[model samples]
Target: MPANAVTQIPAAPADEAVRHFEAELRFETDCWDTHEALSQQADPGFVLLDVRSAELYAQGHVPGALNLPRRKIIASRMRQQYPAGTLFVTYCAGPHCNGAARAAAALARLGYPVKLMAGGITGWLDEGFPLERDAAL
Candidate 1:
């Protein structure tokens, strides 16, 4: 038998896997879940931030998401816009882009709760969600 990549490394024990997966949920949310939360609830309990460039953001971005590029995630700006207890969900172009992660890190450093929207814009579109265009800053 040949050694294949799938089994090259043994899977973690059930208990370890459970803990790892549970922890991941804390830092990530999928596009479908994000869309559901936004559409179903009047107060979704989190702010969705599009961390792409202003130009890209204007072209098209997740509905209800504010265009706040990763570099523009300033502590003072965030504080002024949202309360300290606000939870921030950030997304970028897609899986190929790390803007969401960068924005999440910035938000965390500013003492805000943050989560990365896995798959980002690509994921949102894949889920058949609509994007809002010509959004103002």
Candidate 2:
């Protein structure tokens, strides 16, 4: 492997690749769009779940996110609380963190509808969205 050489492992057909990439892109954009809508209170169709710690959530969080730490999510808990088929958006600190993935995975395993917000709070902040906090903040 030469330092200046380019190594190509494999590639999908251009059209196939385009469609796959577009779908992936759509997933990300759709998550953001859903967040934007929820933040604006336009529709209450879904839930934004903050998979971070209580402290983190207290400091700041997405406007309408519900704090349900990654470790605490369980099928029984969800069943006892929320309805059976609720749409949920799980988010964490940001791209650097995996809390959202952890939470989403748990929810998925329990047959819950869940989407991981691409960038988490960092992404929201980057998009210039203000954080909602407890009265202390």
Candidate 3:
């Protein structure tokens, strides 16, 4: 009998798989969780950042997300705007876009705790969440 593609590669030991998945949760969040946190929590305890260009952001964005372009994620601006130890969640156009990862990396390098919102705008919409329109930074 031939192995199917999924079983072609050996699976990791259960313990190793558990560790890997657990570690991943430390770095990424999904759209639904993000929405719930923002809407339900009195203090969500994290800042949601839309790392797309200002124009794109104005077109539509997650409610409560601040428009901060990835290229503009400088340490000085971050420090001036956000106090130390602030948790930042970054998202971009969607899974196809790397802007969220870029913003998250910049925030991490600047010593801010950061996580990527896995599905970005595409995922948010797919979850049937409404986007705020015409807001400018």
RMSD of each: 2.0, 3.2, 1.7
Candidate 3 differs from the real structure by a C-alpha RMSD in angstroms, to one decimal, of 1.7
In order, candidate lDDTs are 0.92, 0.81, 0.95
Cα displacement (angstroms), candidate 3, residue 129, comes to 0.6
Runs of candidate 2 exceeding 4 Å displacement = 1-11, 22-31, 40-42
Reference-based lDDT, residue 107, model 1: 95
TM-score, each model?
A: 0.93, 0.82, 0.96
Model 3 Cα lDDT, one tens digit per residue, 45-102: 9999999998998999999999999999998898999999999999999999999999
**Any idea what lDDT model 3 has?**
0.95
Per TM-score, the best of the predicted structures is 3
Question: Pairs clashing in candidate 2?
Answer: none
Task: Give per-residue CA lDDT, model 2, range 18-133, as digits (tens).
Answer: 99988775334344685667857766677789989999999998887889998999878999988978878888998999888889889888888777788888888887778899
132 in model 2: Cα distance from truth in Å? 0.6
Clashes of 2: 0
Best by lDDT: 3
